[model samples]
Each structure stands twice: as structure tokens, then as C-alpha cells.
Target chain A: MLVIGELINGMYQNVGKAIKTKDKSIIQKLAKDQTKAGASMLDVNTGPASAQPKDAIKWLVETIQEVVDTPLALDSTKADVIEEGLKLVKGKAMINSTSADDDKLNTLIPMAKKYNAQLIGLAMDKKGIPRDRNQRSELALKIVSACMEQGFPLEDLYIDPVVLPVNVAQAQGVEVLESIREFKLLSDPSPKTVVGLSNVSQGTKNRSLINRTFLIMAVGYGLTGAIVDPLDKELMDGLITAELLLNKNIYCDSYLDAYKKK
Target chain B: MAVDLLKEKWQNKVGTITIGATKAEGGTRASTVTVGGQSTLPFMFGEGDMPNKPVIAMEIFDIIPEEWPATLKEPFKDVMNDPAKWAKKCVDEHKAELICIKLQGTHFDFGNRSDADAAAAVNAVLEAVSVPLIILGTGDEEKDNKVLAKVSEVSKGQKCLIGDATDKNYKTLAASCLADGHSIIAESPIDINIAKQVNILISDMGLPQERIAINPTIGALGYGMEYAYSIMERARLAALNGDKMLSMPFVCFVGQEAWRAKEAKGPQSEHEDWGPESTRGPLWEFMTATCMLQAGGDILIMRHPKAVEETRKYIANLMK
Candidate 1:
């Protein structure tokens, strides 16, 4: 299970407050707890909470790395924030996004290459997120081709087919999973497939259960990882179960250790 | 000739797995049995040499199993109460090339037995049967670890095959097997991708490639066997076509799956077209085992002695 801890993002009120106040302790604590909790990568996002997202993102990346060795998934909508975070990161990190759109790819891919960072390419183009598998698959192939043209290793490119909320768009999850399956068939040395997992459970009553179930089903269709809160036990349990079912964890030997720690 | 191509170009060589170490090696078994090391598909003599034929293992229980059909129950009626005696019957009468002793007692619903009980059962069965042994856990994660860990320790240096390691429980079992120098059966639920992933995980833990057997769970005839067959075929093709990660020899649990299905155990009166339970049960196992062998199964774990006899005959005929 490749956990991309969601705690450092500016969406949460405390994290938002920390970004505004420039409280290094809050950033440091979130990073420390998430890393200690076994997050393979911590997501550092500074959205509208920061008047200067580029500066805030740089601060989070630097502070987090000071305490932990786990890699960062530099999450941002603004190119500047992503660029600043990528520049400050000491080692190879993951750029949380680029889209199938030529503009985003043109800007972000070069920065990713310059920083030697892995990238998450969302399955959306100039028209925005596709609602069907064929469109999603087309967008994925386009992004993958762009990455290839830019001389990126397929392994370094993660395809996110953009999971929509299940309550609002029931068919979207299945379509995305199908797209991922189709993408696996097309790409040699298939790029890792991931998703914004919380999108599937947004506004749902048992959000954790919904997210985890969808994750397992997605994994069955060849999803390699996801951006999710590592602290959610149900989601963690589902990941462990999916890893076992997919035979990614051999005999579930990791579950015993996870269970004991939990 | 095609043989020249095999010698010069084929990359798919099934690793030879020798079970049970003699005193000269490290363990205390009278002899060892080797399987795998096939340079071509099963019985494809014209394509390449079949360095070793698939081997048969009789499945014996550590405790009297209540769920087994009457046909199986009748054969071991006398020694079902004793694990050692039961194993001896499987080895001596069945002429089993290997013995698979399932530790079912560890899974009782009335709580569970201590690890020592499992260890004792393993030791007794090992002593009773001179043929190489395969130890299977109870399928429960925590309980299996407790029992399998103990069995691994007691059977150390024997070079046994310990498993049914699913993704959930592979780490401890793989670690235990690694430490004990025993091989393992990496069982997956009939998906080629999963089979490859599990193989990668086990290999990542530093277990030698020769010490692992992939069990891409086979279904009995009339029980989605075609799907299992296709998955195994695909897995074999991938390995042969040079996917180094998936090139391990395969093991099939033919008996456990075959007899458990309704087609094998139902009364003849209920499904007259299916024939008698006694005949259908062993035949189901035999046919399933044979199909898997043709699909490149390196080891078959069978329940009934008749199934073993029938399967051995089929293998011999194919080889001839």
C-alpha cells in the first residue's frame, strides 16, 4: 500500500490556519505523525489558504523533509506552488498533477523533468474531466504519450482517471476502473494508476467504507496507488485486504504487523 | 530441428525443486524428491526436454476431518484417528511421491490448539512418511502463522514446502520459510497479474527463486476450471515468453478443490447424469489434476489414492 498522507494539505482548517500563520510546528507535526504512521509519501498542498502558495509550499516541503525521509507529493493547482515545492525538495518527489491539457503538460512536465520528479497525470483535457471510459482512456493515452515524448519513464508517470463522487455519478467509478484496465493493456511497462480516493466518498455517510471499497475494486482493475488519508483505519484495512487479494503482499504477512500496531 | 531452437533460444526453464534434505545436506530425511526443471511445456518432447515430470502428493490430515466425503473417509477409517499412521498409509499404499499434511486441527471453531500441538503433528507426520512433505496451514491468518512458524522451526533443514501463503500472510510465512530453508507454495486466486505480483513480493523479500512454487488456484471440473486453466496457461506463456518474474514452477491443489465441489460429492440419485459420488469424486480430482499437469503444473496435491493412481497412469501414458 503506497500511502500518500493527506494531512499536510491546506484544505483542513488547522492546516489552513497554519499556512496563514506560518506556524512551522503545525506543518512539522502533520509531517512527523503521517511519516511515523507509515505514509510512503506525504502530500503538501497550499491552496487558497495561503496568500503566497509558492512560499508556503516551499516551507512545508523543507520543514517536512527536515524531520522525515519520506518523499513528498507536491500538491497544488497553481504552477508556481508546484514549481517552488519541486525546487525545494531535496530528492525525487511527485508532482501531484498535470492534466491531459497541452497547457498544463507544457508547463508541468518540464518542471517535473528538471526536478527529476514522478508525476500524477489526471485524465482531463482542454474540455475537462471525461465522464466515460472511452474519453478517460483517450485522455490517459494522450498524457502517457506526452510523457513519453518528453522522455519520462513510464514507471514515473501515474495515471489518475479522476474518480467522481459515487453518490453523484454512480457510473464514473466503474468507468474510471475500466479506463485503468484498458490503459494497463496499452502501456508496456505500464505506468502506475492512481486516483483521488476521497472523491469517491464525498458527501457519503460512511465515507471511509465507500472509499476503501472503491479502492479495493479499483485495485482489482490494476490501480497501483491512491492519494488518501493514511489515518483512516477502514481505508487502510481495505488497502491491506486488496493487497492480499491482489497477491501484492504475499500471505498477508504485513497485516499481522499492521494489526498489532493498530 | 526444433530442439536446436530450444537449446539456443528458449528462456523458460522451470527450476528444479528438491524437497527434503539428507544428512549430508542438512536435514534428516532418508531421501529427497525433485520436480520441475522442464525446458518445454508438459509432455512436449518434440519442443524441448522435460527434465522432470510432474510429481504427485497425497493429502493427509493432521486430525480426523469431519468434512471429507465417505469415499475418502472409508479409506483411512482405521488410522484417521492417528496422523502418523494416516500419513504412512498415504505414502506406503498410495506410493505418493510427496506427502501434504494439512494442519486442519489448528482451525477448530472451539477456539484453537496451541502451536506445540501443531509442531508435534508436523514432527509425527514427517517421521511416519519417508517421502518429502508439504505442510499446509489452517487458512486462518493469525492461527496459521502460529502453527506454520512452529512447524517451520521443527521441520527446519527438511527443505519442506510450507504454504497456502496468500497476499495477506506472505511476509511472516515467507520470512519463516526463508529462515528455515524451506520452499513455499505462493497461492493466488486465479489471476495472472496477481500471480506475478505475489511472485515479485516474495522475491523482493530475498527468497530464492528456486524455493517458491506459484499456485494460481485451480478450480475443479464444472467449477470454473476453464478460467483457472486459462489463467495458468497465460501465466505459463508469460513465464516462457520471458517474464522472468513469473517463471516459477506451479503447484496445484487438485484434491482439496475437486472433492469439495458439489459435483464431486453429491449423491448419484440427485444428479444421475453425474454418476456415483465414489466414482465422480476421484474422477473429478483425477481429471482436474491431469488438466493442470498439461497446463504446466509441476506438483499436484491429491486426496484419494485412486486419483493418484489414475493421474500417474495418465502422466505415464503421456510421457510414453
Candidate 2:
């Protein structure tokens, strides 16, 4: 499973303070800690809290790369903010999102190709989040067809099924899982599947439990990646154990330790 | 329909390692042997990169062996009792790339020689040969600690690959190897999990993963060699798929295990239907080495000059 470290967003208090004070140490430490915790990539998002979100994303990308070499996910709703980070990334970069909306796809798909970046396509559009499995699949088909039409490589595309909180949208939880399974069938070289994993546990007291349980279940439905807190020990352990049971990792007595070191 | 490629973009890779150090690098070896850094399974030619070829090391013991079969004993007959002469013959006449000195005399049940004697023998071989060396200890933990630690001290800057650091007795020898600037071999029974655990323990003791080679304990042909093959195959696949603990280059004691088998021993009079024992013995050793190499063995510690010659030819062809 590809772990996109989600601890460097401007919405986090420590990160927000670091961005405000221009403290590169705090950002570098977060980058090192998450990479050590098994993050295949880090998400650089200057959340809605950043007054100068464009400049903040660039600064975050530069500061993180100064310490660790893990790849970055240029995360933002704005194509221009993601583009700015793309300009500075030394390795392959990823766009945090493009929704099923035609206009957003038009702008971001070419930007993804222009920057040679992987893209995360959300299963929502300008109309809003779909409420059922069929609706989610319909939007996913739209995103896949758009990428195909633009000559974008499906292998570099990750389609997120737009996970919603189980407390408020209990029925849609099953839809998201079904959407994850259906996403793979949309193209010959199927787009990889990911989820904004924390969204599944919003407002819940059992956040870690809920997130890990759902993440493992999603993995059963062919999910290949997740944007989650790599520092959450229990969640990461559950993910490793789940992959082990799935036979993705070779069995070793100290497999958990091996997974962490890798 | 358009063809779709199935290649994997591996996130991590097996670390490359260099065994011996030269004069420029503070050691007196004429050259060093490098291994690992493979990005795919063995012989997956077009699929991934295999940066270094597997190395073959001839095993020369410190004391004359009491149980070597006649076929294996014949090649080293004259130098059987002399460690330095045996090592020199292996490199000079046998075309050996590396020499492994097995200090069996240090075992409590064996000669139980003093550490000073072991160190003296090691220094003699170092002076006699310019090729790289792998200094192995007796299986006895306490005796090996004393003998190998002394060997490490004497060969301080030689950068020889030294050890058989097990789950139980890794500290003394691993520390000595680290301080003396040598790569150490981490051994495990025919189990992948234990193999990985041994490496993790070694790494925790401050041995960098790159300086360690793995010995997934050898099992001879028809004597559970398949189990060793399977374990090695899994370890290699895991390493290619980015598992760090099982990522070290594998080393096997092929000659030790092959010679111990009855099929590779016993005269024709004892087993007439098994064909001529002389050719059969070396053939058995060669077959075992070939299979293990296919399953990702990067270094083979072998006996039998004929078998080593055949295996070297095989490795040259396979690498090409």
C-alpha cells in the first residue's frame, strides 16, 4: 500500500505556526518523522488557512525536500497552487485532486501532463458528492474517460471514491467500498484507487478504530493507496497486518519491524 | 487491443555491498568483490537491473577435516593440513575469486585451539593470498566468540567478510567486525522469518544493512534443498518488492551440505546403481549450486574443484 503522509497540511496547528513563522525546522522534522514512519510520499497542502496558499505550498515543498527525498503530493483544490509546487519538486510530483467536473478536469488534466505528475481524481463533481454506488461509479467513469481522451496514462492516475463520514452518511459507506471495486474495471490499465482515509472517521470518538477498519475493508476491494497519518502507530500496524494477511508481504517473524524499516 | 506493460515501479531497492578493501581503501587486498543491488528476481533479464554478478568463494578449513569424502579431499590432498597453503592453492591454481577460512579447529570438541593460534593462522593466509577472504567461525557460540574476535583484531584493516552471527551470539563478533571494518554474515535456519529477525537484530546492534550478507542455512540436494530454495526465493521477492530486512545478498554453504549427502559420497562398490561416485559427487554439488543461484544466492562457499569450475562457468554464462 502507498502511504501518503497527511501531517504536513497547513490546517494542522504546528504546521500552520511553522508556515507563519517561517520555521523550516518544524517542517523538516515532520518530513523526516513521516518518512521514517513509512510514508511512500508526503502531501504538501497549504490548507484553506493559508492567506498566501500558493507561496506556502512552494515553501513547504522546498523545506521538506531539503531534509528527505520522499516524493511529494502537490495537494490543493487550486490547480495554480499545485502547479507552483510542481515547478520546485525534484522528483515526480502528484496533483492532490481533480473532481468529475468537466472544467476542473480540463484545467488539471493538461497541467498534470505538462508537469509530468500523477493525478488523484475525486469521485465528486461541481454537482456535489454522489449519494449512491451507481452515482459514484458514473462520476468515476467520467474521470477515467477524460484521462483517456487527454492521452493521460491511467497507471499514473489514482481515483478516490470521496469517502464521507460514516456518522452522517452511513448508507454511503457501502457505496464507497463498492465504488472502490468498480473503479478498477473502468479502464484496461486501471487507475490506482486511494481514499482520504481520515474522512471516514470525522466527528467520531473511535477515529483510529474506524479509520483502520474502513481502510482494511477498502483494501479488500482493491484499494491500493491512502492519504493518512503515518504517525498513528495502531493504524499503520493494522495496515501492515492487513497486507500481510493478504499475502502482499512475505511472512517473517519480525515482519512488522521489517515493514517499518522499509 | 493495445498491449499493457506489467513492470513494477519498486519504491525501494536492495543495497549494494563491497566485501574487501584495497590498499587505497586502507586494506591490502588486490581487489574487492561487490554484490547485491539487484532490482529483480534472478535471471529476470529484461524486467529489472542486476548490477553485480554473484561471487564464488572456495572454502579452506583451518584444520584437516576428518570426514571429507575422497573425491573432495583429493584436490586439496597435499595442502590439507596447512591453512595458508590451502588458501594459496585455492586462489592460485583453482582460479578462485574469494577464499573462505572455516576455523573448525576452534570448536570445543575439535582441536579447541587457542585464539592466538587462530589469529596466527588467519594472518598467514592474509599474507599468502591477495584475493578477498571470508573468515567463518565454528558453530560453537562461546568458542567462536573468543576465536573470531581475535581473528577480527588481527585482520583489523583487511576488511575481510567475517562471521556467522546467529540470533544468540551476534554481539561479540558483530561488534568486532564493526570496529575492525569488516562485513559480517548473518545466518538463519531454513526459515524466512528467522532470517529476517537475525538481520533486524544485527542492524539493531549498529551493523548497517549494506555491510551484512545473509546465510539462509544450506540444505543439500534431495536432503531438503527445496526448503532452502523456497526460503531464498521468498526473501528475494520480498527484497525486490521493497522489504529491507530480507534485502541483503544471500550466501550459501553449498559444498558443506553437498558433501554431507550419501548421494554425493560413498564409493561405487557400496552403491553400484548410483553411477560412478566420483562424477556423481561433483555433479551433485554443481546441481545444488545452480539451483540456489537461480533462487538468488549471491555468494556460494563451495568445495570440490570440479564443481567450483563447473559453477564458475555456469555463473559466467548466466551473467552474460
CA lDDT of each candidate? 0.83, 0.90
Q: Once model 1 is optimally superposed onto the true structure by TM-score, how far is the C-alpha of residue A208 displaced, in angstroms? A: 40
Q: What is candidate 1's CA lDDT for residue B58?
A: 87
Candidate maximizing TM-score: 2
Model 2: which residue pairs collide? none
> lDDT of model 2 at residue A77?
88
Q: Largest DockQ belongs to which candidate?
A: 2
- In model 2, the runs with Cα more than 4 Å from the true position are B1-12
Docking class of 1: incorrect
TM per candidate comes to 0.55, 0.96
DockQ scores of all models, one per candidate? 0.02, 0.73
What TM-score should be assigned to candidate 2? 0.96
lDDT of 2 by residue, A49-137 (tens): 89998889888999998999999998998888888999999998899999999899999999999989999999998888898989888
Give per-candidate clash totals: 14, 0
Tell me, by lDDT, which candidate is best: 2
Give the residue spans of candidate 1 off by over 4 A: A1-262, B1-9
Model 1 agreement with the true structure over A1-262: per-residue lDDT tens digits: 4578888888899998888887889888888887766577898888665787777887788878888888999998888878888777887799989988898998888888888899999989778779799988888899889888988888888988899998999978779889879888658878788888998989999898888888888888888878888878767767777766665533333343332221
TM-score of chain B of 2: 0.97
How well does candidate 2 score on lDDT at residue A19? 97
